[model samples]
Target chain A: MVAKIYRKCGDIDTKEMLFLPYLRYNQSMRETLLHYSFDDSSSSLSASGAWTLDEVERLRTLLEGYDKKLRTHSPETLYLDLSQVTRFDTAGLILLRDYIRDWQQRGITVELLGMSEKMRKLYVLIADAPQAKIVLRYENFLAEIGKATLRTLQDAYAYVQFLGELTVHLLRLLLKPWHLRLKESVYHMKQAGIGALPVIALTAFLTGMVIAYQGAVQLAKFGADIFIVDIVGISIVREMGPMLTAIVIAGRSGSSYTAEIGAMKLTEEISAMRTMGFDPFRFLVIPRIVALIVVLPLLIFFADMVGILGGMMAAKWELGISWHLFVQRLYEVLALKHYLLGLLKGPFFAFIIATVGAFRGFLVEEKTESIGLQTTASVVNAIFLVIALDALFSVIYTEWGL
Target chain B: MSRNVIEVENVVTRLGGRMIHEGVSLHVQEGEIYAILGASGSGKTVLLKEMIMLLQPLSGTIRILGDDLRTIGYKEASALRRSWGVLFQFGALFTSLTVAENIALPLKEFSDADATLRDEIVLSKLQMVGLKPEVASLYPSELSGGMIKRAALARALAMDPKLLFLDEPTSGLDPVGARRFDALIEKLRDTLGVTVVMITHDIETIRGIVDRMAILAEKRTVAEGSLQNVLQSKHAFVKAFFKDINV
Candidate 1:
């Protein structure tokens, strides 16, 4: 227990300072190592020196030793003499509190003495602090599996609901064309379409060259090198051009859409727009979707031309097939249905990328890092769905005997 | 006489090809709450950043804890940095870490204190900042606006800083929360003997807690002193700033 003494120094002492005895280190040494001594006659443990963070390790070792000594002896009362403590901090207070608590719990009376006013205030602050029970959520394997399954189901349901809402809004905008954000739509077109031209052209050209080079080698072995034109033109127009373009756009545009919209959501811009009676889907989502849908087919058409051109170049270089012959053969054999079908898949792929991107954007939570997470998920989900749809198209084409 | 803990003399700052502070100067004495006040674009935050060494002034001498910022080496700079703590406007807590971990991060990096000691320190800091123990296990995202600021303050005080820097400490808090925050800052300064330098626009906070202040205007410090000392200034910007807020 502390004595209520007022010192005429500039410091003000509060009533809580009485919770522990106060001492000022006017005559004490400027610095001392934290050490404890047992006064055998008085049966009291007296500690001296500066008890602070820098001396925390020595204090811990001494306390552990003291705990062992006390348990073996089982003293009726424990006298803690902190009179010689020159300085103290929260770390020192914590260690002392824990040591006293353990002894008191062992049915021994612990009497704290010689606490400085600063230390007592700190001690009371720590002692009276509400113990917040930390709740750690732990689930067994089966419970984790069940929770994951439920989360997946909820996410699927949300995605489907989002799709339905987007469809209704799209139909409404179609009926009233004046409501469309044409300027934003055009801006996105320039970003996702025109900006992507160089990369798409490069990848498609490389894919066609690879296909033609491989086909020419194989056809030359069978003495049917002329058939390389059919292989290059058919594969590039029917599959490679559209597939390559879709994959590239999904990585570039889809991720950007998710990041942009997710940031806007994080900053509460979307909430601000909604409060003003503007649908976020109409203002933010639809323009991106419309831009992708309009430009994807155009990108695919351009990819097809570049891909065939690359294949013609590869054919001429590898198999000595003249450009005239290759073009002439492509015109005769590359069916209109193949090109039209590849172009048709563009809109569907664009829809998948744009919807998934925008949907994931809306999923961003209040945390700053969630934008990165949603963007990554958007790109991954768009690519996966595009591939799945392309496989379904392949199955339909085979079933219909196309 | 109390010593000057931080002294900024004729600091000249330019950012992005624009001059921000032409010649700003001020001094923060030991064991006092000093405020930096300015208009919206008057570069109060920039000046705070400069003092914290996040931004270096184009030409100036910033002496903190007896070391010149312009001449301090990397090793000395880090050692000096550990002696002070900064509480940013938006809390700036790591989103991935729990409140406990955020508070303990500096201790973990700087000291060999064991896990039990670290946990105790974290709990003590939480209590000191008037935060409940349960809040420690929660992430930064789970916290309310006031709780976020308190949690951030706990983390800032984790190192037992000799000086504290706060940027718009009460900007987002309600009036009551702002007042409580002001009281907390005063109590912490009294108990810890730490000098505080803060940038705040809250007139209530300035009137209630600030011991001395400097008003920044016209790309430089136009007024400096206690509230009454600066109130006598004839500067137009200073007059406009405190016109509505009667002491």
Candidate 2:
């Protein structure tokens, strides 16, 4: 298909621009409409893929002018990311892809950067991707990397340092009697521990029953169906109790702490505290950490008992055994080490939750969206760290023969 | 008459490549109500916050009450800020605490200043702003718009701070309320003998109470001194700041 190319300068070879092989301007500009003669009823219906090679060249010429205009007029460097172009089977995409490549080959600086998976695949299909030399107006690869590097470096470094500071604060509170803040400590326990009991118990109970029901079906085949109590009790007491409690605390109280601090930061209330002679660590963080360390274990203990009972109920019903037999088998298999192991993990998990939550909150970058991000990051990081640490502890304890 | 008490010298502040404030230097004198009167986002809040070292300058010095604020640590900054009071743009009185508790917070936190001392201070401050001490027990959620402003002003003055930083004091108040607010500010200044730095776009606030004005345009000081001088200047941006205030 042939299309007309608008030439800005005289004596330019039309054949060199190979991308000029397709596309049609369905609607003509005033000058083009006046110059081009068309027959009456040349189509009452509009053209869909009625594009010609000349029209494609015309588009290229117009787009080149736009590129020049952009460079001269607007100071902002545009990210012409192609990710929005979902699908392509037409020469329109090929023309754009080619122009970008041609500009690159000629060492013409591209102020615009593109990002498109579809375009990327298409570009790779046609050529080994155009190595466009981006003459960035403030957004070079290094500048962008430097930007991301600075942001990530700042975010990660600040987060790590903040976590360290929080650790020191927590250690200081634990070691020194002076900064213990007993009253605030009690208040935090209520916030992080006691406040979370209902949800933790409910979740643990359901989880235990689910685990027991599954285990009972397997054990009944071996005529060792009575052992359903062992799996549910052991798992709940050693792994699920502490881990689930920690996750619940992270999801609930962790998000709460992040949001609270985030809101304070957004409103400059935290800044107000700094101006008012109060260290946020001492006033805000110490209380929450103390609360979590003291309270999360107690919640886990409660969850453990509730979970075992729930498991016993599931086992008794699934195996058609008496409740008393289930209780005997549970106590027979459940060792004090399992109880101790779960309790030990509780304080560690609580520390991670409170530290991550408070750190995420303090790290909130003073905006509306930062609060949400901090809250999400706090929960995710807390859960991930909790599960990871639990796995490590399990391995360590198994080797230690605990 | 520049009774200069605060000296902002070569202050440069930037956030992620864009300079929010640059080479912004200005002064506020003792006993005079200085206004950083710019059409909002002229870095008025940024400048105001720098007075008490809320936002640290990237490269400059701010002398508040004859002491350089930048050299101080968190403790020192708080101690310096304790002597001054700030009214936030959002009327940031503690929503959790009652109006009385909100006003009494600084004193309670920093001082063992008794409940009796607090009650007396809270009552006096509330009365100073035309709010009854009876309304002291009510939470911030319960207060009306003008009341919240008065309460916020009352909190700002509760500590008897020698320096007061108010960001758009009459922003949410109605015309009558805003006028009354301006009057209240005047009365408070006269009685307290405190240096005030107000950032406001309210024309009435300017004409009525402003002793001197600084206009921030193009990320730096466009004009400084009396309201009349800034309004009359050949600088179109400064002129537009005043001209647009009425519009």
Candidate 3:
């Protein structure tokens, strides 16, 4: 296939095989014709893209090919088919009309086999007197049952795949041994979970201080500056702790899972597991999930504590509140519900992070790009799901009076 | 100790549209080094992978040690895993583990041996592979390409299994190092009474020590037996290959 393309590109090395794939105008379209569709199955002698003038140049060039090739060889029916085209603007009009004239002058019976309505209308509009006389092969849009059926099947396939992967994820948690793969899984969780403690702690603490300072300044005018403690404590424990923990995990552990698995896949290390009579999930996935399940809640606990303490610093100085009252109000605001809520969401968040990370890794298609793509998608998708689910929980918990 | 006839009966593996290994099969006798040889994409590694149960065949069954891996559960599969050892192409030595710890993986796994005994065994395996006891403290990244291969071999030999598998045992090595490593494999195979199977594209490794050679080709690929039989194959692709090498 590549060799056949080299013939079209006029003996260029693979390096010179530059595809001006993102064409914007006629020169770009010509560049694409010169470099892009060299081995494409769909391209006839001519295919057009991006711009009308380029499309016309492409048509004129294709028309010239018949005259040039047939002048020496025997003549055959040449088609000015636009059936493959899906859209058209005005400039495609003048080029086609001039092309038709050029073909007639050369005594070639070049038939316009297929024209979209828009293309035909554009040509007719260009000829203004309404005598473009271009033939239009009308195609029924709804009658493309084949493509529609394929698309519907593809969508259904994607949906079924989602359900299948979901089931696999659940079964992996339920059925895989907690005793053995714990070490391997926890090994990663430590790097991703426990090891990230210092930074996450500091981040939460600084964030708490910042939020408290802002809250104290606002509350001071209202003679409620002391309330900054409640704000920081309640917010960090109930919402920020879980939210921040997940986001941190997504960035740290999630991307690590993706890159680790990506590199494993790249190196055939996953396949090595298969040869060794071990499921990759057993050796790699199960362990990571179990460890995170065990550790994420703990990290969230620490993050909450750190953030609340940072809040306390602001409560003491800016709010002119003593440490005792600040601690008291903090304790008052932090109900068991807040702590339970954050911890309850721990395993769920871990599950999402692990699944998204592993799924992205699984989604890699053996291209160099898949490494960055998988890692980026891992964090983005994990964070998105985390935020989306958090909103759902907020709605549910509020309605449930938690 | 036992002759494991790893029959890959009518195996077929496909990824999307391409048929990677079509109806590939091979048999290895006890105390024999069955070398699977091919270029990078010729599915040699895939064929060897089946021996370890890494790849699933779309069709056919793989019988290792009189058990079908596909029929077994995870625990059962893992249980049977100790019977064979695999040396990955890049050594796949746990970068986190030192040379001794890496080699001790299988021994620590299959045996209920004490730590001191395991450490002693690790030392012995390293010695057999011509590594000094002091080198055991170094991690995989610290080792040279040749040392990594040896450490991986030591790990594979840790269990003293009935069968051992190595992928590209001498790849990325200097010629002298490659030769020395090949000699170590030869020496270990003789003394250990272990069935050895290797995936290699190294012609010199094949010539020097491979007992039987599986030349992975197209549909007619994976012809295995004595090295002489493969060298004299009449298949056009096989014939032209040997002709190029002037074998």
Candidate 4:
């Protein structure tokens, strides 16, 4: 509906039309009653209108113009006349309060004059009400550093406690294998291990091919191209196969674990299980951890085979080394100790991924957003810990003169 | 008597081969507090959603505020939407934004008010819904069940809508809170002249606030009138519904 600005000109009604369809003004037939006149000598402004939401736009514009004038004139006192306001709503009350506040902030004393009883009550309700205060305290650089240090220490403490509980649960399950849900463990095995096989094989194969191609380029310069087989075999069996498989699983199965259990946490399903006399760790965490531990070694062995096959194919293609010759050279240089070293890290990697994923899941609160946050944290923490553990193992093996 | 603000005629809706609503028709007048009541699986929410245009009826016409929803263009449909507000069952406040920002969203998007004016409107809307200005800074997750409902109500009223739609406004609230909410709705209707369409099964709300009601049964609106009229309905399901509520 169109907004009509009404002006009362000496007992004659005049209306000015303006298009404001959103206003939906229904009481346009009310007497034309809005007029604001300024008295420069007394520094006073008088308004007469309905002053409701329908006229808020025009009112704001008028008030803004008056405020600018007052700022230039440097008025010490401003009087507001609102007795002629025929109607008022929350919007009108807020506008009046804002104007009073704006003038008061500029060292002008605002005084209300000739307000009706209803207007007086409304003014008191809005203007006299205490304004809400928001206090912001700034922290110094040292305080920020101290806060970061304390948070890190607290997180470390929580991690240790989580590890302690997991160890206890694992030991208890070992003492009673009959209590384990074999069906559930197999289900998780298929998900975490079998479902991840294609990606793991693809990553390991590509890494092996890249290593062989790069090694061939450097070795051919020194007439040492035949040693490409040894480089591919030793690296795949000792490091690349296990590390790549673990990283892939951490991205895939670790995130799924966090999301699933985190959703259950949100629905209070884990609490329900505990209330039913079930150990949540044994029911939820132990099965997942056991399944990954059992399947990861086999997955790493498969990755090693695929990686070797990829290297052999690249070797034959790049250096004219036949598959038979490549196999023979691989056997001569790749020792059982190197292969065993990679296989041995499988359970450790699996333990870290499963525990970290479940730990993050259990950390989820009762909010839907927590599921997404914990899932992201699960993948990132698992991948970082896996790499850190791999570096630790490399340092230990190098110091042992292997 | 006022003109009808909502007129749904012979609406038929199906979901997954199940007929949720069949030939259901109802109308709500202006400045009315109309309630839609139904038992479980009786399509109360489905009908509400259809009226809001979230879901389309298979065959029907919904006329809201003189606009036939089926034939309206996107601009016209949005303009019509701006004339009304909806409150979902769970107070579906955006979790990422604080209370004040959520209330300011419609104003910021639709109106060209400055930041200071927007802030004043937000505070006034909060106060209109009986919420303190301090509650504006808190996130939805930090609010209690009742506080969330109030905050959602404040957001719904931000645009000064002529029609307000509420879905189970008192479902999760305590009895005292629910009564206070019903009183607040009644007060808003009286003060703002807003027409309200609510879907609920709360007997207290039906008795205290609703001016008229529709009972969905037998895949249609079997009864539509004042609470007393619906309670006096001869239909078996309507009788059982009110009897089940001990009303």
Candidate 1 segments whose C-alpha is farther than 4 A from its true place: A1-32, A39-50, A70-79, A83-87, A130-135, A138-141, B243-247
Error of 1 at A265 (Å): 1.0
Which wins on TM-score, candidate 2 or candidate 4? 4
Report the alpha-carbon TM-score of model 4 versus the true structure.
Answer: 0.86
How do the residues A1-402 of candidate 4 rate in per-residue lDDT, one tens digit apiece?
A: 555454445532222222333444445324223343334434666666567665667667667755665666666777777777776665667877877887788788888888876566556545644444422245999999999899668766887899999888778778987989888889999998889989988998899999999999999999998999889999999899989999999999999998888888888899999999888888899889989999999999999999999898899899999998998887898889999999999999999999889888888876658788889988998999999999999999999977
Which rank order by TM-score, best down to worst? 1, 4, 2, 3
- Give the better candidate number (3 or 4) by DockQ: 4
Docking quality tier of model 2: incorrect
Model 2 over residues B1-247: C-alpha lDDT tens digits?
A: 6456789888888867779787888888888888886665667787777776667778888888777886777777777777788888878887767788888787677654456445655665676788865688887767898898889988887656779999889888899889998888887777656788988888888888888878888788878888767767888887666666542
For each of the candidates, give the backbone clash count.
0, 15, 8, 0
For candidate 3, what is the DockQ-based docking class? Answer: incorrect
Q: Which ten residues in a row have the lowest lDDT in candidate 4 chain A?
A: A11-20
Worst 10 residues of 1 chain A by lDDT: A13-22
Query: Model 4 misses residue A361 by how many Å?
Result: 0.9
Reference-based TM-score of each model: 0.89, 0.45, 0.43, 0.86
The better-scoring model by lDDT among 2 and 3 is: 2
TM-score of chain A of each: 0.86, 0.63, 0.60, 0.80
